[model samples]
Target: MDISAEKLKQLRLERGLSQDLLAKQSGLSLRTIQRLEQAGGGSPESLLALSASLNVSPQALRHSSVPTISHWSFAQRSVQLSALLLLLALLLALVSLASHGQFSIYLDLVSLLFLLLFVPGVTLVAAGPMGLIMSIINLSLLWQHATGSLAERRFLQQLYQLQYRLCYGSALVLSLLGLVSVFYHSPHLSTASLQGALGVLCLGWLYAACAAELLLRPVLFKLNVSIQAEQHTLAN
Candidate 1:
């Protein structure tokens, strides 16, 4: 069975299977798989195993050319950016909760509503069941709060806060999973360095998101104030 390094790599990538996953499926050692993909030489047994695991003929694997990496499309970039933003917002809210021991329930509600209504609502949309459950809980809480009982209001506030945390946590986890899936299928990165690089990418996205928000907050506040002033003047 003749195979070239480029051909093996291309075939593996075409299947969108990670080296570790391919190794697991083929019952081959990870190192052996990696070596064969990088160096092009493998035993007949290894070649047959890989071809079977890849769902390709051994001859096809031997003849396939290296595939060219394509630039990320607009939709892909938009999804990545949305996921990054969600991650950043979640991290910031989490930090606030940890440092302050409490957070604004109204703010949390507004943020959750924003996430559910806009800004990559895919995860929140997929979480429709959870949202419905939370809505029922919220209605019950609102009824209690409307009775003018301090204890009920406090309890409802706490529940709302908890719901906020849960929703944000769920969204963050879903976003991270999507990102991992994208990266796992990417052809540009080597399998060995992919995990470490993914970790760094996560950190970098979080940092950039936080930094951008911080830098823009003042300008955003001024813009809001100006808009409010103009609206008041028009009303007069």
Candidate 2:
């Protein structure tokens, strides 16, 4: 059966078992262990063996790790749907704006991709490769344990915290660079030069604001709500 590779890796890590050790403990081959963790395909017997070794139920290794839509309250579902629709609306609006037939200095496919990549790229450069890698690992761990552990909730909070910081930081960096360029070339700055520098400044802030408001914030809200609801249920 198809299982959750993330969940499997999480369980193994939580138990402090290396792949080689886990294979020996589970009586499965090392290659099988790697394959299961990478692509999540194994028989029922393999699942049972891994579960026994990991001290979790076989179902826990399956793909039903996260809370599903059916488990959410009506209000939660409505909020999620609204968030999704809002994203779609924002996307359509962007498409409409770009398709207005008038030439734009910045509204094109290349610029869109650059805007999307720039924040994370700059963040990685600023935070260092190792920091970004660890953050990603924490994010993956957060995905499965968000509602199950307080530590994971802390990570969830940190997730959005990092999101906004990167967004604003990138925007501010670009704006400052733009201003520096404008000042450096002040004596010879033509209309096109002024517009180009200002475009960098404006696009930086615009993309950052849109990403925070339309994408990251909504996702963080949903996860926070789900975590709170799960905690409330456990408390009661």
Candidate 3:
């Protein structure tokens, strides 16, 4: 296997362990550790042993040997863009049907403002500033991935997973809050109040599903494919 000598040495040093100590802990000979650290290749068993001793995954100890494409071809760009547009069109069609052909209901400023504010606001509050910032940075990395950028699979995976969890979590919170509001006013609940509560539930669910399906799922699938391909390449 192709191990990363620098990463191995760095991991060992970060844990404040000497080469001999790492070798002893991993149950490998000191010479084997020295050779692996001096060079970059090792058997999978050696890689696994080192990873276990270092408290890091085997993948973390390996290097990205595949060179990433700096730019995508025109056809690749067109296909990606077309898929995005088609998904948008489908979403619009579904929304129109759900609204009984009144697609303009979705264009109402109040609902739009509520959606624009609620999801991100809740995510920010829930994840805190640094977490939100990292998620945003990872989101940008995901955009780069779409442009034939094959680096940072780890960050891209984190971006989608974080957003996916936070989005659904926020939606559920919104729905529960709305339900609480309705229940609190049940004694004097009017038609308008009922409608408002239902709207909140529906909008929260709709926004979460839209965000997940349109953005998170595709990036997650792409990341999975990239990781699998990387593993296959490394194995070969």
Over 4 Å off, model 2: 1-75, 108-148, 230-236
User: By descending TM-score, how would the candidates be arranged?
Assistant: 3, 2, 1
Q: Estimate each model's TM-score.
A: 0.26, 0.52, 0.52
Ranking by lDDT: 3, 2, 1
In terms of lDDT, which candidate is strongest? Answer: 3
Off by over 4 Å in 3: 1-86, 90-104, 107-131, 137-151
Error of 3 at 117 (Å): 5.8
Can you give the lDDT of residue 46 in candidate 3?
Answer: 89
Error at 233, model 3, angstroms = 2.3
How far residue 1's Cα lies from its native spot in candidate 3, in Å, is 6.2
Worst 10 residues of 2 by lDDT: 138-147
State the TM-score for model 3: 0.52
Q: lDDT at 15 for candidate 3?
A: 95
What CA RMSD would candidate 2 show?
13.3
